[model samples]
Every structure is written in C-alpha cells, then in structure tokens.
Target: AIEHDYHDDAPYYMLLAWFKRVPRSSDKVMLLTHGLMNINRWDLAQELQSIKDDKRSEQGTFSKD
Candidate 1:
C-alpha cells in the first residue's frame, strides 16, 4: 500500500490517476487517511489549488524542455 502526507488533500480521482499510472505488476494500493483532528485537511478543497497551479507550471516547463 502507498501512503501520502494526508495534508496533501489529494482527491480520489487524483489517487486513481496515480494508481492507473502504476504498472500492472506494481501490486500497490494507496491508503489515504488523517488524524481525527486533521481529517478536514484531507479534503484538499483549498490547499490543492496552489499545488495544482504549481504542477501545471512545472509540467509546462518540462514539456518545453
């Protein structure tokens, strides 16, 4: 299984995309969770906006390179 920081707020669709990108033989499963007090952070409703923007910029640079 795979685990993330939990504060990253990555959604199911994002997780699924990552999963699909994995090789079929990887046999990996991703588990996302947060502490009771931190559950809201996992929602990613706000924190991810900046991350998404940054990722787009990074991808653009990589493509240009």
Candidate 2:
C-alpha cells in the first residue's frame, strides 16, 4: 500500500507518503513504528521513536513557561 501510493524508495519520503494515508484519529507514530519494525527496519523505528520523544520533551519544556 505504501509502495503503491508512494513510488519513492527513500525511507523519509516513504514515511511521509505513508503518514499522509493514516487516519487522523489513530496513533500514527506507533503505527508507523510498528510498520517499520514489521519490515525489519528496527533502526528506523528507533529513530522515529526518539524523534517523537524529543518532540514531546520540547513541547513539555515550552508548556512549563
């Protein structure tokens, strides 16, 4: 589905394409992480997880002001 929708081979581009198709009500990060892991792309999954954690941390820092 991701490949058919997004014809790019790059992980970043592929992720962007896949994300666009995901429903707004869903836990997109978790879904994306699982998808990456399902394809044995644990490294990408970890990277996505870290990015999500960093974003949350930044949001928390800003909200404390």
Candidate number achieving the greatest TM-score relative to the actual structure: 2
Off by over 4 Å in 2: 1-17
**Cα lDDT tens digits for candidate 1, 1-65:** 23565446566667788768878876332222223125666555344555666878999999998
Count of clashes, each model: 0, 0
Supply the TM-score for candidate 1.
0.33
Per-residue CA lDDT of model 2 for 12-37, tens digit only, reads 78668887898989999899899889
Query: Model 1 residue 47 lDDT?
Result: 45
**Model 2 scores what on Cα lDDT?**
0.89
Backbone clashes, candidate 2: 0
Q: What is the C-alpha RMSD of each candidate to the true structure, in Å?
A: 11.0, 5.4
